[model samples]
Target: MMKRLAMVFVGLMLIVGNAWAVPDGIWKNITGAPAYSFYMQTYVGNAMLVIVAPNTETFWVFLDADDNYTNGFSASQDLSGAPNSLSITFTSDGSALANMTLTGQLPATYNLSRNAQAPSTGDSGDAPTLISPADGETIAVPTSASPYSMTWTAVTGAEGYIVQICTDNSCTNVISDDNGDWTSTGTSISLTHATAGFDFYWRVRADLGGGSYSPWSEIRRFHVSSS
Candidate 1:
């Protein structure tokens, strides 16, 4: 009886351990764009989720319980001022299906694949150089009549580039858009509208593919005039 009880205890422990297993690392959406991704991490026994939208808006969700993962996890948070909920189920170690819902919008589903390598900041020498809307230049508000163009010097081996516009000098508060993150295979991107009467900062980075990216270019600041 003693031996049988020990075996049962060991089996229960194994089941409990497997039940607590959660997916970690970066998972990118395979189905569509604007590209969406999630970065799952655990720190000090706390589970954290970072959601990246096509427009480069990042939403961080903190899970309340460690027991949230039972072959999958679910969470909800306010993202970009909208109430958003996310549910993910692991189909395999390398694949998952995510169901997301945002207030006032249709619920959407995504097929995800784990990146073989997580993205890390690459050498600054490989970063792109900002060209137009020169640092500190004030410009008329972007409009159809006066659309503003942003340009950057191309990197030699770059497959693409990412442009981020922010409202702060530090570039933490990125400007949000519905089209997706500003990614281009070319050197320039045009903007039709940006909030007028505010200072804006911009930067560029080269996308080298396979989860590799160059360090951001030196940030540049510009102001948009309401007139």
Candidate 2:
């Protein structure tokens, strides 16, 4: 009788373990992001998942290649619904996932391959703010100085910045500024190449370590009084 009890206990433990397993694998998006798609990706240890919304603005978390909905790697089966689209929050370095609502449409059945390509760049982080020379401020060009300095607040996770100064507000006409399209480790840069006495538009974007970049800060317009 004790032997039989022991056997049952072992079986129960196996069942519980299987029930609480987190799938550790790579899941690819069979369907490319739609033109109207809003997709998000999260990295959980060895597992990487992408959440995509192809049809509506409302977003959903990852749907495994086997058509199983991964509830943010949690062992929970409950899914929450909300009117607004869902987004995934991640820990620094893009490891460990969180803040998933788990309420979105499951994609049609698709095959998910295990342990594919490693996670590439484009991880999430807070955006950097632009500062200095104040927005829309006009600085008189020094009589004989060849360059003017621009500055911005440093971003915590950013390793460098891509600065663009344009002749137009839209940044289409790239101004001949320092090392045009230069990536700077410091917050400030001096532009010796741009033409003086013309109104110019400038913006900066943070390079979040890896190839990921924060959205460009609001464009600031500066005027160069003729020397």
Candidate 3:
């Protein structure tokens, strides 16, 4: 009989640590009703993991390869449709089954393996008020600055946001400013990178989890004046 050997790729050495499960929490019930299910929005990454124990239907979680561990080795689950919570356990290696207890089933995804995500929610018939830079106004990028930041009103239940820019006022299809085009931070994404001596138009929208986007906010235009 021949044994199968896994091929290890390069660059896997740096991040090749034992796969440890972060203890998010145990849940109680799964699959029953709505409005009470442990609902959460998570960014999917390299792999998707579903953990199951003795009872309850298996759940799903996603993780990215570029996550920075924060708030300790913790995890969370979404039980949006769960009528209650359930007890669960995760196993890696060289360990006995975990003593698990939880309510409101939670799905935990590792940030490194998951891209920070803002899901699109269907028209839930609710609107959020934005609370930063006035829309449709011309702003200036600090002279001689490598990066700049933009601010705006936050939409309710937004998982993430997308910022787009164009030189033409009537242009559509906004590109992500995540590549440092605008030098953004936190909930306020960046929008400072621009070709000098060019007038630019910009717009931003919040992405709620699932498959919904908030109505596009009023457009904003800024210019990168030449030195």
Q: For this target, which candidate reaches the highest lDDT against the unseen true structure? A: 1
Candidate 3, backbone clash total: 46
- lDDT-better candidate, 1 vs 2: 1
The candidate that wins on TM-score is: 1
lDDT of each: 0.56, 0.47, 0.37
TM-score against native, each model: 0.49, 0.47, 0.38
lDDT of 3 by residue, 23-126 (tens): 33222223321222222222334322222221111222322223222111113322332244332232222221122223335533221122234222122213
Candidate 3 global CA lDDT score: 0.37
True-vs-predicted CA distance for residue 67, candidate 1, Å: 33
Candidate 1 vs candidate 3, lDDT winner: 1
Alpha-carbon RMSD of each model: 11.3, 13.9, 17.3
Residue 221 CA error for candidate 1 (Å)?
0.3
Candidate 3: misplaced stretches above 4 Å?
1-146, 173-185
Candidate 1: lDDT of 209? 72
Tens digits of per-residue lDDT for model 2, 59-87: 22333334333443322221222243332
**Which model, 1 or 3, shows the larger TM-score?**
1
Residue pairs in collision within model 2: none
